[model samples]
Target chain A: MTKTTSDITKRTSIGAQRNPASEEAILTAAGALLSEGGLAAFSIEAVARRAKAGKPTIYRWWPSKAALLLDVYHRQKGETFYADTGNTRVDLIAFLESLLGFWKKNGGEVFRSVIAEAQSDPAALEALRDYAVTRCRASGIILERGVTRGEIRADLDIPLVMELFSSFCWQRLLTGRLDASRAQLAHLVDAVLTGFASKESHAQ
Target chain B: MTKTTSDITKRTSIGAQRNPASEEAILTAAGALLSEGGLAAFSIEAVARRAKAGKPTIYRWWPSKAALLLDVYHRQKGETFYADTGNTRVDLIAFLESLLGFWKKNGGEVFRSVIAEAQSDPAALEALRDYAVTRCRASGIILERGVTRGEIRADLDIPLVMELFSSFCWQRLLTGRLDASRAQLAHLVDAVLTGFASKESHAQ
Candidate 1:
């Protein structure tokens, strides 16, 4: 829920002395390998080889490939914010437009690997889950206001709402069609708000 | 576009006649590898080794790993359908509920790899894009009906809508929180439907 991408490993005990120079080298090497060949070409051995750091040093700091990737993403993640325009509609659309643009510009590849990495490693899965929820939590205020104003049903499941928002944007970014106009985003916001609004509950 | 998973080669003119028996073995082998280790462990060498098929054979059939994964998904894809029942709300909710349960039960791993593979490989990305569009096409009819009946906005961008729907479901499934209660899903569907409903456009 914090404003910035917190270093993923600070939560876990990586068991290595904090050496800024070594850490920088490892991250740089890993990032290069990931960029050049994606996940398949990424390995601790390859990273150690490239970074000229010992395998033990790398292992001392990070537990697995995914953990390393998580740190990379955390360090690299850019700003993701939603301004509190007081109008949920305006806030949601603007947040989504920026969110889509951000992912397309920088976060798509990292996001893809994190999601894929989560598939096999429980730790990675947990880290990715935490990352996603934390990202979603930033936009929580919008939902809170919508609920307060009765624009969104007070009983609305906020987490599910976040899931809907994230998934929608992720889908577009993943598929390379995220260049939706603000007007289009406006339409989507309207539908989602209408779905979450109280007026339609009885109708359903 | 196609009701079933079409072979990648069939579209590309691979020229060599695909032997059904070898094709079945490669798919089975690749599926197992993907399931066991996700994308990291999925490789032509590993698959060829396990299937006892040559590397050339796998390449002759699937131009890339993503394509192969797509074919596996097509072969193993479980039922995803919605009966008209005259209500878009009811039909969409049912479709999503089943979609969630199906992936939890069977499709999660394969789906994960295909998505991950698409991140770096242009061919795989194209395959994934095609697969997503093809999958979305089936659900397009639902939106069409909603438009005709004035339930959904007549000018709704169907492709973007589909991307939103798929991404939401996929993010949940990918994150493994797909066990959302039917009531919860109902809220999401309601929210999404409301977002796309015709009345909102006028309101906005």
Candidate 2:
């Protein structure tokens, strides 16, 4: 029987040492293609052509397209800004503003594509969940700082609170509301920080 | 030039009065297809074939696959439960429980598909946004009741608060976390109702 493309790919990739330069080229090309055409125009064949890398080589390094997409996203997201303003509300708002700004610039499309991919691929979903957990833990430092500073309650659920904040951001990004004003962000922070119950209700 | 399928469909659909029976059949078939196979297997062609209706009939009425999908979602979501326990926290929790239960039952798959569709189609995005606004308004009644009963602050941002609640639910649903326990739901409600700030900070 003739060797199929998968057979050839597996044969070629076996014991082949990964080249860092090729990986960088592949990632850069993937990012540019995604930015230029969005997810609909993204494909491994396209990435191979753009990066001058062989298709089997791309597949050998990245197990799946979702894996490659996730790497590109991580590469694009160089560093997350964590603001500590000596106040929970201010710190949270500043952090969100910085995050949203990054999203509006380029992160939104890439992250949105990841989320959309998750809807159809279980591996993508797993990757997204793992990434979200890591980011939440990193961002939870703000709330932890608030706790240490005596601004927030010590017993507060950090994971849940961070989930709330991330959910708000995700909704905005997915719905194309990345331009949320500072006032709106302030309102969201206030709602989380101060609650909405009347003073009378709290007293009761 | 030979008459194309589009021409035939357009010619056949123009001035053709809608049959409620056929409409019901189409909606029913679309819902069934989605339930069995999810979005990957969903299409107007499959819907038309399943409904025993011509493609033109389906296209003539629904206009687009997104329109038909939205209709199926609406039809599947018969009525939303609005709980009023005379307490904002209890009412919100109960309402969310009802909504989540409905989502877990069947609405989750349908709604997830719609959200996935919105990611690629601008029309679907618009439809999703319009539907969200309408649903938010409908659900805002619970918060409004709280305002009337003096449980919540009169100046509270109803739309914003409802948005937070919806965003939380959407995140959970999208991330396959619809199985949130009652205790977790209570925690969310408490976080929204009591805030996370320490009493001393509030006093200061």
Candidate 3:
């Protein structure tokens, strides 16, 4: 869609210099649109209209809808709590609780839209993978702390463990199970931390 | 979209009686469409055109696009292998290998679309959860065999473990990581079966 004169004036006043204020406005508008209407209501056109910024200006920075969605997701995630309670199981459980709670609040829908978008858009898929990698590394620190404290096996695959944790959360989020109880989260963490093998097998 | 005369004729001859041939034709057409175009290319209209049937006929039986997608998914899943070697780890690894292989082939895209569709459609989400419950119960049978063989702890939460396994596979599939190796799958199973507690924690 061609930019109208008003769009030009808006762009010049707010976004021409790539100022943080314009970026915040765009991100806020996108998040609001997503929260209000879900993925079906989200689009460059919608975001531009709501933000009063020109489409060309948005494209100048975000590149794709997925990128914008990812930013919205990250912005919300910045408020998520990651626990470090000096105990791996406890820390893991607390981390899960905070993460799931954040998701239940509103972050889940935003992230869900991102996942849905990734299914159809190559750029979205790439953005998703890259985001996953970054989150994996950051979250692996929990496992690392456990290793350091001798609470977890040093040889344990931290990345795999992180994937297991994330997969559990992702499945719950996608399947409308974000209301998983604290006890359930604890059970999951305990299962991961302590093997499920029968005592006899462990002895053997 | 209104049905043409040929559409009515095709529907009457093949689908009026809900014959096996027509059901198979519609399902086959749906699967082919999903496989070729992913979720974006899938719809009742497209399936009607491809199968030479009316959209009403397709909807009459499937009810919703999600229902149709679920059927297409189940049809492909029928070919998946679920092992029962009397060993939980072996069986789990083998099952993952077969499931991942199936996804890497074509099932991943179809299933991914189902997940994507569920994000925006309540009917799709319901269908997805219903399907997950069925799959979880069936797959839990593998772990039950382990319990019967005294290889697993009877007190263990079967449903939770099942969720872990499915969640792992779902994450890998959704993130384009369906190529996970046997070694990785084995590690995951072993972690679950043997627990990850440090030596000291186990002694306690």
Candidate 4:
């Protein structure tokens, strides 16, 4: 009986079972304000008012406006890589497809505002940088696995490959000239794959 | 005598001769402000005060802040290219080297600020988009020439290729993870070239 009581106490203390409702509400209100009025509309007082929560509660979790904005960026623009397609080509295609889908569907406004805020705000800039490095590592893992399987060149730099893929998506996002036609995506996937394969195979 | 008189009239009326001293003063003042204070310091009134010129004089030539900023971006960024180096390998190397150099030396702050401002300001965003598309065309030309010369795949999407190239630089810039290391730049160029080259050639 004593052990059981202590176990329950530890689990609750960890806060894994804490209410997610307030957090969700705050994020939703913040997202609304960001899209409607850019970063200027996102003040601590306003967020608390919108979420029907106390200012102290909001401050208890997030240290600054930039931290809260970073949390929102993570929720909106986060990438989860699934590269177990067995074939490297299939895996790479899947990755690019999911990535492009996110870029097309959900990333427009959030990414735009984040980019804007990151320039003047040092904290936002750090968040953006940390996100990039993490994403690069995710892609690098897949490329490295491909190398082990002899699908990609042994001497290839996985980090750079990841950068090239990221560079394409980010360029379009920032410049507002993204064309997501099937043929274009296909061409990009094929060209990138071709370049990663060995030279002798290229001549054939 | 009539021809000479006509030429003189055309030159004087068009104001074809730029006042070197004024241009120098404006560029110098603009550079200092941009480097020191980011985009907020680049207003017409601010520039006029710094350059000791009237706001009307600044407005007379630049039309708006975007155009003025663009002129500054051009001077600082210098030039980026993906020229045909007779071989795909050399051309790609030169392209990456020049781009990395530009990003590190001149584009770090101004481009970052420009991109962030583009997100919030519609007009600035449009200008950035236009500049990106036009400049990217230079890289496209190199890739297209490679295809024509049987060095690269002919079925490439030029726009996507340009995006891929820019994404790397912009991501690093936004994130402030730009390490201007020779090995890193070289690796990026190599990986991208291979990724975009013909499949048969890559197999070798």
**Best-matching candidate per DockQ:** 3
Candidate 4 local Cα displacement, residue A107, angstroms:
3.3
Give the TM-scores of the predictions, in the order they appear: 0.68, 0.78, 0.79, 0.70
Give the docking tier of candidate 2: medium
The residue ranges of model 1 lying beyond 4 angstroms of the native Cα positions read A1-80, A195-204, B1-62, B195-204
Deviating ranges (above 4 Å) for candidate 4 = A1-41, A44-64, A76-87, A90-94, A140-150, A196-204, B1-41, B45-63, B80-87, B141-150, B196-204
TM-score of chain A of each: 0.64, 0.74, 0.76, 0.65
Q: What is the lDDT of residue A41 in candidate 4?
A: 83
What is candidate 2's lDDT per residue for B1-204, written digit by digit as tens?
123434421223212477989988988899899888987778999999999999988878766787678778877776556667787888899877887888899788778777777787886776676666556566677877888888887776676668877887887777777888898888888877888898889999
Expressed as tens digits, the lDDT of each residue in B123-148 for candidate 4 is: 77776776676566545666666676
Candidate 3 chain B weakest ten by summed lDDT: B7-16
Candidate whose TM-score is highest:
3
Better candidate number, 2 or 3, judged by TM-score: 3
List of clashing residue pairs for candidate 1: A191-B194, A191-B195, A191-B196, A192-B195, A195-B190, A195-B191
Candidate 1's residue-wise lDDT over B1-204, tens digit each? 223334312343333689999998999998888778876788889999999999999988777777787777666664446557777788788878877777888777678767766766788777777777666665666666666665666556665566667777888876777787899878877767654233533264
- Which should have the higher lDDT, number 3 or number 4? 3
Every candidate's lDDT: 0.71, 0.77, 0.77, 0.66
- Shares of reference contacts reproduced by the candidates, in order, are 0.43, 0.64, 0.69, 0.61
iRMS of each prediction: 5.1, 1.1, 1.1, 4.2
lDDT of 3 at A197: 75
Q: Looking at model 2 chain A, report the run of 10 residues with the lowest lDDT sum.
A: A7-16
- The segments of candidate 3 whose C-alpha lies over 4 angstroms from its true place after superposition are A1-62, B1-61
Report the lDDT of model 1 for residue A74: 62
